[model samples]
Target: MTVQSKQGAYHTGTYRNLLLEFGYSEEEIQRRVLDNWTQIFEGGEDTRIYYESEDGLGYLEDTGNHDARTEGMSYGMMMAVQMDRQDVFDRIWGWSKKYMYMTEGENAGYFAWSCQLNGTRNANGPAPDGEEYYALALFFASHRWGDRTEEPYNYSEQARKLLHDCVHKGENNDGPPMWEPTNKLIKFVPALDFTDPSYHLPHFYELFAEWANPEDRAFWKEAAAASRAYLPTTCHPETGLAPEYSFYDGSPNHFHGFGHFFSDSYRVAANLGLEAHWYGLSDDLVQIADNIQKFFEDKDPEDYRRYTIAGEPFEEQCLHPVGLIATNAMASLAVPDSPRARAAVELFWNTPVRTGDRRYYDNCLYMFSILALSGNYRIWMPKN
Candidate 1:
């Protein structure tokens, strides 16, 4: 397999289980990870988000919205592949391909961002975040379980085709590309002009550069570098809080008043944490993680609120306080050597996966944090 020059987990094949590092037994860590999965995927109806149809397909419901979304489906696929649950991965993929994949439209190659439980389209548009995760998760599935000869089960081909469409969509005057070609930056949606800071996943793009179609490899490589360079500019100098949406120039986009730190912004820390764990965390990333952890060190999750990048709080309380906690703890991966990192981990360990109305998003982040901090989340390489 080809390897990057950087000393990342993909090259070294080594991962740190922070819970074990901090004196948790290996058995406990493994059990905790499994328990969280069971709770999310198979527990009581109150806790479980995954539902399987009699036809052998499955979908993750956004409990709050009461619909299936590409974001949750792709995330469930990624989580399944990471945990070696091929059954779950295939079911989710099948459901997604059957229900969400749009054909003969402006978004012909893309999946509808949202769909009803009965597989009805909620909107005809696509979300770039979902497309990115879908491509990456499919790649992981191909490497982990091998591709099939059938349509949706041809995992590697599915991934490559998705990536190809993401970059080349506008060439034929069909739909706009998910990323801005000139800057190599991902837009919030295929048709939008602004970007979500949390969508900048450089680590995933690095792998795409190596595994994507040869003609698109250079573009993926440039996209990876561009995201890495763009991230630091999105965060505040002191607070390190990033806006949910920003412009290509890294300034917060005031469009729809999304320039504040809120629900989507929480993923920025979690993304940086995973990227730092996979690739080497740079000093700037370390500082960014440090700033975020320090900023919330004394704050209670119950009081979490919408805030400006400068750390000013709004009257609005956070919709996903549990998610904020999980992501903040995940940020510890970037600052593993700091006492603050240990503190964050301790806090996360004490928390439980959320349930009820808004549990889907929060619990997904919680499960990811569990996998990542325990080093269970890994890069699946080609077997041959």
Candidate 2:
């Protein structure tokens, strides 16, 4: 295994082992990962606005929604932490929190899904998950920087309090569980997709444990655990596709034909995009990943061709499901010494779709990949 240098927390042996399990040389797996990184992040950037390149911005041009831009920021921050690219990480980190945070909005101080190009105010409309993303990022960034009481991470404290209010604070008034509440309860009564499982959210509990009341740890863990477990049990068998909406009771919530194409269609590619490890797989998550992989890798080309969303009729031919594939692949990279792990160090060369905020997403993708691949893929490319 490659020994941890002063620069990296990642080791080399892990990647070697992971590749061997996949029945390939460590170099081959490393090669594949490196290739994917370079290709996907081809025109990617590491600027204050990640999607933008030297010539112009990608998603920042008012794509009508800030979902991609906001999420992209989170991805960039995450990548920065993983790569240990302190300089790249810090600048983008500051840029995002300053512009994208939705601390004061028409909606109960929700995070804006889109930001204006001028960098002054949000474009409009809040996404169901936007605030959650901000909170998640702040909490993780605080943890990554190893600073409990710092200026930058100060965002985390407020972010968490908001989540508690929105997701958990029915105590203040009558409302639904943290999942979804009437907007009037606060502002914008957006219906939520309650079901669809996969609760193993990154750093949720750690944050709860770190910042929330101690008594609340198990509660948060249980809630998340139950949600994640629901997927393997309640999802469709043939497609392993989860329904768009799940119930508070873990029952199938959405109406028939309500499943999102992203579940099955985007899943394959999304798996590749995952920035988490694939190992130490919880029985449920492993099953979810396995089920998703089976559908994609095993499906015939005929089955893969032109598909429609549950409600929409748009159709297009599948072109290897690259976008979603990278997402999923990112997950596999997270777990070191796994049958699926990728090397974390490869991020330097792998590149990410999130270029301008390069440190954010790129670092994240590398973090998981290097961690998992190093622990397992040691046999073929031993160094440590």
Candidate 3:
């Protein structure tokens, strides 16, 4: 990721596969992920908006230059590979190593939030949220690349830090990752906000558990299991949708917004568009959709999901039908030949842009969920 600069324009790239490769056939996902691998590189690259985008990249504008931490960048980069954009993957990976932290600084192995629009940490310290993403990305990177040395991170050491030093476990064993003890866990800047880190953590650790020490494996397993348990553990048997919320003591805290559309959209997006499927590891996107649909199906218009902290439910309903992800996921997995599959993809493709959004919380999430959904790089579509 890059910082906003007024004098000159620059861009940075990452290759994390946000959804593991949804919608496209596996071969298609591989093709795009491989094709766009060069944007991660400093100079050597092919042609793609990733390498050269007119809209601007980095912090200059909305070309996804924010959240350049290892987890964020790595996750995006990995997903780029999943999208079959190897050019983007290679470019992002090639350049990211220069900015990566390997020294034994207090925050070593973790990463800073932003770097130069052109290069690495010519900037400052990473956001405390780094641990959360680093852990998440590490899981996928190791699985995808199998070379920790290549990424400037030792999976063993990094996982150790995430479990013992970086994570802040709670009653559910799932909470915001710990930042510097120097902050004594009270710093306000990184205190859990309404940020999006929910589904990733589970996917991360589940992959780690596959290659970890027996003890480490167990730890990652527990963490993954806890995350699954903490989420919408139940899905609709029919439509497969459910509520989205951050809970404290199994109750809601709506500071961000209860079952907010963005998070809800993500669940829809992830399930309908998830790239990978591992039993007991990554949560099932299809099942999640069905349950979410169930969660809201029979409820009345006045029905609402809210933070119980205030002892009240705010009346709200999702105004957008990002369910195209869900429909696409089903299509790619089960009904590849069906007309509805193409229609579902078309609905998602035209949605919000050509179709117009029915609801939105912030344009950031609107962009985030859509882009993350597209990270798979479905080549069957015209652009791919």
| lDDT (0 to 1) per candidate | 0.91, 0.42, 0.38
- Tell me the lDDT of candidate 2: 0.42
**Candidate 3 lDDT score at position 163:** 50
lDDT of 1: 0.91
By TM-score, the candidates rank as 1, 2, 3
Q: Across residues 1-384, which tens digit of lDDT does each residue of candidate 1 receive? A: 122245557667888798999989999999999999999999997788999987789999999999999989999999999999999999999999998999878899999999999899999899888999999999999998899999999999999999999999999899899999989999999888889999999999999998999999999999998988888899998999999999988899989889999999999999988987798767777788899999999888899999999999999999999889999999988888889899999989999999898999999999999999999889888888
Off by over 4 Å in 1: 1-7
lDDT of 2 by residue, 149-268 (tens): 665546456556656655554454433334433221111123344443332242343345445545555555554444344445544454444444445443455356534444323432
Q: What TM-score does model 1 achieve against the real structure?
A: 0.97
Error of 2 at 371 (Å): 7.3
lDDT of 3 by residue, 1-384 (tens): 121222111011233332343345555544533433332222222221234322232221113343244434554454453444444544555445455543444444445556654554644444533454445444444445443464334543454555554443332433334422222221212335322223334544555565444555666666655545543332223434333444322233345454433333344335333323222123354344444333443433234333122223345433433432333333232222344434444444443321222212122222333444444322121111
The collision pairs in model 1 are none
User: lDDT score of model 3?
Assistant: 0.38
Candidate number that wins on lDDT, 2 or 3: 2
- TM for every model, in the order presented, reads 0.97, 0.60, 0.50
Q: After superposition, how far is residue 331 of candidate 2 from its true place, in Å?
A: 6.4
- Report the alpha-carbon TM-score of model 3 versus the true structure: 0.50
